[model samples]
Structure formats: structure tokens, C-alpha cells
Target: MRPITAIGFDADDTLWQNEQYYRLTEQSFVDLLGEFAEGAHITERLLEAEKRNLAYYGFGIKGFTLSMIETAIEITGGQVSTDTIAEILEIGRNLLRHPVEKLPHVEETLEALNGEYLLVLITKGDLFDQERKLAQSGLGDFFDAVEIVSDKNATTYRRIFSKLADGPERAMMVGNSLKSDIVPAIAAGSYGVFIPHALTWVVEHVEPPTDAPRFRQIEHLGQLGSVIEAIKAA
Candidate 1:
């Protein structure tokens, strides 16, 4: 291993808790739709609408909010009231407030590596919500570059690296999701370090590759410092 020149990070569960909020909102949506709309129809309709909207608008709150609205209309036979729409919009609006609840040791580990490496934030999501989370996180100044991408597949990451950094060898991605964060980065000729989170979404988990060449796993975000150190000394 050589000295790490560029260190990219995955947001959401890596730096802060995100999925739980979505889960809570989803449960609320289900309960509300059942009470006002058709029986148990909103969940299926919302998922389908979200999938279609992701194709058009990509992953983010705008698409999600639209999908939520579309699902409500479908379930209610276009009878959803303005009050109901306002309530749903309110939930989407609150999604942007990160509330500063962070993953364990994310701050200390980022502080440890900021000066030594070219710290960058490489995250994906809705523009408004992702930006709000970054603004709330006081750690934003430590990063030299920030990328809010549409997805974390290998192709997307390759394009991001092409535009942002010079070489893959010196770039290592530190993240929580094995699928979206680790697998794609490693596939793009960069190293990846995986830090498992307790409530990883099913969409973000992948099977461990049998032949991953340069992948590292850590118990928590605090261990990232040691991983970088070991990589540096190698």
C-alpha cells in the first residue's frame, strides 16, 4: 500500500443515521393510506411509482415526494385532499433536517484524516436533503471536494473519480454499505473500506466478493484511522 492521497467518504449511514428516518416515514405513510385510501394499496403503488421516478429523476426527496403524492392519488382514486398532500409534504420537508445524530466515532475519525489526506465527500441522494445534512454536519469544511451523485454503481463512481481525482491507486473510499459503497469503488480500481452499520437497507447490502482484491473491513468508523495508517505504512 502507498500513501493515500485522496480519501472519499460515503454519506448517510457512514457519517450519520439515515435509513431509520425513512423507515419511520414509510410506516406512517402506510398507516395513513390505509385509513384514508384503498386497503393496503399504497405500499405497492408507492414502490412502483418510486422505481419509475428513479428512472426519471434519480434518487432524492423530490422524486420520493412526488412518488408519495402519486401513490396517494392512485389509492384514493384522485380524491386525496389538499390537507393530506400538505401533511405528506411536511414529512418530506422534515427529512432534510439531519438533527446531528451521527454514527459512532465518525467525527473523530474524520478529524484524524482530514489534514493527512484529501478528504472528499462522495454521497448520493436528493439535492435538498443531502445539502441540508452537509450544512448541519459541522464537519463539512474538512472535505476539499464534495460529490452528490445519482447512484453508487461502478459506472457512476468511475465517472466521479475521472472528474474529481487523478488516479485510482491513491483514492480509497470509506463507507458503510458493502454494495453501493465498497463493491463499486473496488471495481473501479480504487480501494474500499467497509464499515458495517446496524440498520443497513436491503437495497444497500451485497454478498462479499470471493475475489475482492483490495477491500478492507472495520468494526466501526473509528477504525478508519488505523486502516489508513496501515495502508500508508504498507
Candidate 2:
């Protein structure tokens, strides 16, 4: 029941559009390899490649692009042509260059809470891509700090909260992913707020910690103020 002081936000799909582009590119990937396998099989293999390559490539468009190529090679039994590989690379480049579209209520919510709380952007992705997206979003200045990390975990939340605020007890982490944004933050002793997005990566999906006292779910960023107030009152 500690009063929330610092607020951590997730960038992809939380503040703006991200996963939709990935989904689109993934469909493109599936189509490019349609000769080798069915769309569902291609998609499944791509997901497997992505999961296997996480430790190798981490996250973001670069990893996704590589996974597409890997899946192509796997599906085609190493007979996939270089032309298809080039096309997959172009798909990734397009993803990197896609426009950053802010979600509704993102700016107003940040503007409303900016000076009142220590607002930090804690996200997981390729460092360069994340930086580019943040700069392009034009929402960078609203944050007191920006953390583009390799992954999100309880230890990561604990370190960030302790370094940026009055520790995890006074911090609240908000985002769409139950796995990265909510459970870990709650485990770190911070208030965890869920703001669901229409498209979330399969890897990021997990069961919500509804029974956790520090866990909360809001319809959107616009409702965040009320949740904060409720937490404060509690």
C-alpha cells in the first residue's frame, strides 16, 4: 500500500503501435515461403526460430528478420534461394523504418503525470531500434529516464525502481504484457498495472496475477489516474 512515486511505462504496443507491424511482416514472411510449407506451418516455424534465437539476437526487427530467414532455410531444407533471403531482409528494414504511431491517451496521460511522478520508459528491444522509435514518437522528453533493456525481469525492475525512485515499493510499472510488465514488477514489490493492447506477441502473453494485491488492470492509459488514486487511497 505504499504511495506510488515513480511510474515505469512500456514502449511497444503500450505507448504506440509496434506489434501490428511485426504481425504484418510475419504474414509477409509466411507468404514468401508459401511454396515450401502451409501458412500455419510457416508461422509456427518462424515462432520457433524466434524463440530459439532470442539469446542469439535478443529482440526487435533485426532478430525477427533473422528468424524469418532461419525459418525459410529450415522449411526449405537449406534449399531456399538468396533472393527470398534478400526479400526477408527488406521486410525487416521496412519494419525498422515504420512510423511510430502513438496510442490514444498516451500523450495526455504522460502530460498529466509527468511532473507529478518520475516517469521512466522501461522497454525490451534492440537498443538502436528502441532509441529510434522513442525519438520518432516525439514523446521522449516526457520521461525522466529511458531504459532500453535486453529483457524484463523482477531483478531488472528492482534495479530500475531502486535507482530511479524510492525503490520498488513506491513504483508502478504499466504495460500490455502480463509476463514482462506485470508479474515481474509485482514480484519486484512494485505496483503492476495492465493496459491491454489489441496485438501482443505470443511470447509476451501469460496469465494475469489477479490475486496479487499490487496488481491492477485498467482499460487504457486514460484510466490510469483513477487507478493511481485508488492505490493511494488503499
Per-residue accuracy of model 2 over 1-234 as CA lDDT, tens digit each? 449889999999999999999999999888888888999999998899999999999988888889988889999999999899899999889998999999999999999999999999999998999999999999999999999999999999999999889999899999999999999999999999999988998899899999999999989999999999887887
After best superposition, candidate 2 residue 71: deviation in angstroms?
0.5
lDDT of 1 by residue, 1-234 (tens): 355678899989899888888777777778778776554567667878887788887877778888899888988889989998998998877776638578888888888887777788999887768888888888799898899888888786677667777666668888888888889889988889988888887656689654786799999988887887787777
Alpha carbon lDDT of residue 191, candidate 2? Answer: 92
TM-score of each: 0.88, 0.98
What C-alpha RMSD separates each model from the true structure?
Answer: 2.4, 1.1
Q: Which clashing pairs does model 1 show?
A: 60-126
Model 1 worst lDDT window (10 residues): 35-44
Q: Which stretches of candidate 1 lie over 4 Å from their true place?
A: 1-3, 36-41
Query: How many residue pairs in model 2 have overlapping backbones?
Result: 0
